[model samples]
Target: MRGFLHLGCVYAHGVKNVIHVMLENRAFDTVFGFLNHTTDIENLVGKDPICNYVNVNDPTSAKACTSPNLPSKSQYDPDHQYYATTNEIYGTNDPNVPLPPVAPMSGFVQQASIGALKGAPIQDLQQVMASFDPANIPIQATLAKEFTIFDKWFAAIPGPTQPNRVSAHCATSNGWYDNSKIIFGNNCRSIFEDLADAGLTWKAYYQENPPSIDCLSNLRFSSNIQSYSNFLSDAKSGNLPSYTFLEPKYGNLPQNKNTYTDGHSGSSSFANAEAFIKQIYETLRASPQWSSSLLLITYDEHGGFHDHVPPPKAPNPDGITVNDPNHPGVVYSFDRLGLRVPVTLISPWVPKGQVIHEPNGPQSDSQFSHASIPATLRSIFKLTSPALTKRESWSGNFESYLLDTPRTDCPTTLPSVVQF
Candidate 1:
């Protein structure tokens, strides 16, 4: 394992570190918390709650990618571009059928505006609460029937894979914006660097293996990272980093047993990701580290899931112009913005149903940027490297997810390692 340590005097003396596991391509669309269409749930209720969670392919019929605005040089019509560039992977619009108006923000918002309320009459909580009969419901039912917790969700961005992943990590795309160049530039520091400099040990674990392991011949930092299967070796040898990342092998098969080899996106799979995550949670929660450690479960990005909110403006270094905010001579900064993938922070400290409503955006103090995952690690460990933890404020404080009073004994029961 590659260790990151800051020997400078500014560091805090000692801290029991953290491990970050980034589960790539898992989305809230698959989670139980929220669903774009509630009607889809009427049939699944009273069944296994796990049935509520589904893979992207389950809703593939409704999977539609939209492009808000595309540059003219790209292969799309700005006025009638029904689908974005990435949507081309599946199919393009026929054009003979006139494109509908830009996708509406919300079905509720649209229905109420147009005076066409269907399904149930839901004006407020009282109406919704009275409508459901609890007598027939199971006591173990975990999801809320009706609740409103607000947070930032992405609206207009459209793409398939790598661009969305890069946007979530750095908050800006280096312009490769698509999977065609997933291996482009690597000169910049990631949220991981920020935490490492702060004296935290972080690790990226892949179910089958690590990412970018074979392509080290191009950019640097190749040897710095390791695979997920090797985590046990690192832990036994005391080389465990503060944060850990897990990448899936595109399909369900293990990396070595593949008879067919597609590119990175094709070769990587998720068939065993859910089981792997559960195992990791069980190991940590059963150990003495449950209270102090935090686990962030989020998708790399939305694989064209429909979210009703618009992408908010963010501070960008490579200024791109966006008309909504109306800032002159400034390029659109994606730092604090992008589409919403399901982000769930799992730890003993994270209260069940505790929704963080960061008013400004994810990068705001109220909201946490994905980068905040590393920021909290840096603050907790007190590594003093500026470059690595430069964007700490934009991220969240992982400490908030810990218990106010330290635990003398470990938790008696662990949360069922759940996947949707």
Candidate 2:
């Protein structure tokens, strides 16, 4: 539904900056599958219906245009299953190519053990789904050795956005379970609270003035401190918050048609996401705050992309069985994590070409949850707060990459941060 533009431009900010790039809805299997050989790129880059009209002179004609990759249904039904329009476009389960069999237990927990469970039988679809090879893991070492910390959000658990996002802030995934639900408030005692308590200055920069209810309410902070569309302006004015939470603009652009109407593949969200990110990065790079700041780019959740590896089992407090919806009686325990989402940590302190192949969990090689973010914040500001949860311990710690040499790959100069 949405169209993508090759902006073909690079913008940079000033100095004393740290940026976190959250790759939303990035399925580990999908990303790794394509990255495995690169030919699989088609699996993700579906033909955007709006692309045909992106630059067309006629808005009416653009409205009439349609991409075959559009989603056929509005919402997933409990009884009826849904198939991705992307699959139908390419005429196969995987639009790219039939991915190799997912390795058994191949996620953060799995990789921590160096694929020790490859010979074990994959018990379910979750196991069969995690086929991403760690050999080509994208945790650039340069980034890892220099920046604060590099890790995965590890959707290794299940449920939906609210729970996962809560996990990102709270460590425990039991707070909320639905997209339309609110689990936390402004005083919800998050990493932001911890930072503020420690006399640190941090703010969340959202793309839209106010994000959806969940994002707006979950953080529980007032709109005065949060700027959805003014991130560019804030950066340009050297008004960098101690921490910035960048979110996708949803679907306002023509390229992101599905995001607006729900009739398409939500490719517009992706297109807008890419453009917004470029702008943010460029502005951040050009800002005076580039050197001292840190950026954490991560997605809130995976958007049901085919992953080829299995997420390992962690203790689920709410007993939400990941990947299994058949239990009509009650939420049951799942033996795996949720899908894998992409997370990027950018800063002057991050090492170049360094990949941290850790699990993102408290244990070595374990993957992380959203709750880990607060932990990282806590560490950065040296805050004293009760542990968000058991997994919270694994969330923070800049020691690994903090000592690495700074990246030489960054540009010497960048574009000016945009003004509101």
Candidate 3:
């Protein structure tokens, strides 16, 4: 129920606007994999010597797994369902299957091949091991070159979009893994509630209504939800809220056209997503609020792409475990984080061309996950009591990357999306 006019008055002291754009289903190595091929730009992919792994079950896995020759323009959506993501992560397609003592991280090609064989041609399996050219994702790549990129940022859960997204907003999915059941009745407290409790304002902008909306039981917050057009208008007028969550257009909707920007499979090209990002950046840069705003661009899930890095063990968000009757006997403790996803932090405050990774620690290596979203918000708002979850309570904050002074050399525009 908070209005834009009141946002300025309520948040005048040390209050900076945080804009989060959550894109769908892209892995770090899947979209930015080609950055490893670049010589001058120091990146996580190519720093280590390139090596190939052998998967006897997967004939297509003999060569170097990360290939730029993989089709970037194709509309092939890899299998990112709950079990499929498990296969892509643990390298085992079977659900609740025991993994070897030394996890191989070698089941991608086979999983893709198996996924393709179901309702898709067997020959299309090669698309799973393929990645896009860095040139094709110039906007994201350019941002990485200009701001801070998290090579170790991971999804909160190793499942599908709904659960991972729920973690980002609520710190826990409330014992649900897939997107089947509606969450409005779940009574979960979201960051939205946290912001409101602190007397700060927030907004959720979507091209169309996203699945996350159903998770919120309170209809009073519905007043803050607006169409995507309102986002552009607010950005230009400097009427942005203290926190903004933006959702790209999911391609499955009836109104979605060839210019889908969500970057999900079946989209015409990744160019659409780049163009969308470019516009958002330009709008923010041109506004008076640019200096005071921080923009975070990240993906919800890995979308079944091949990533070399294994996910690290993580603290359980809530004590309640997920015992889904559908996957009988499959108990989820929410202990392990998901695969790596591309995470770029853009602001005048961040250092140029900075790459952040896990810092040494006695516990687990320092890494960013979807839980970091709420954790950072809680830190910024200075909320003291009633933490969301232990995972978020221990998560690292991105504010460390913000500089005491702002950079004037941030690029205003990026290369146009190249058509295939």
Output the number of the TM-score-best candidate: 3
Off by over 4 Å in 3: 1-15, 36-64, 93-96, 117-123, 183-186, 219-221, 359-366
TM-score winner between candidates 2 and 3: 3
Residue-level lDDT of model 1, residues 92-149, one tens digit each, is: 2233333233422222112221222122222310110011122211111121222121
lDDT (Cα) of model 1: 0.37
TM-score of each: 0.56, 0.61, 0.88
- The alpha-carbon lDDT assigned to residue 126 of candidate 2 equals 25
Among all windows of ten consecutive residues in candidate 1, which has the lowest summed lDDT? 71-80
* Per-residue lDDT over 4-70 for candidate 3, one digit per residue giving the tens place of the 0 to 100 score: 1111122222338999998988887777777743343323355453333335355554433456655
Which ranges of candidate 2 are over 4 A from the true structure? 1-23, 36-153, 183-188, 212-221, 252-269, 317-329, 333-336, 359-365, 395-399, 412-420
Q: Order of candidates by TM-score, top first?
A: 3, 2, 1
Error of 2 at 299 (Å): 1.5
Write candidate 2's Cα lDDT for 336-405 as tens digits: 3565565556666665434444432345434555655765666555456766565565343433344334
lDDT per model, in order? 0.37, 0.43, 0.73
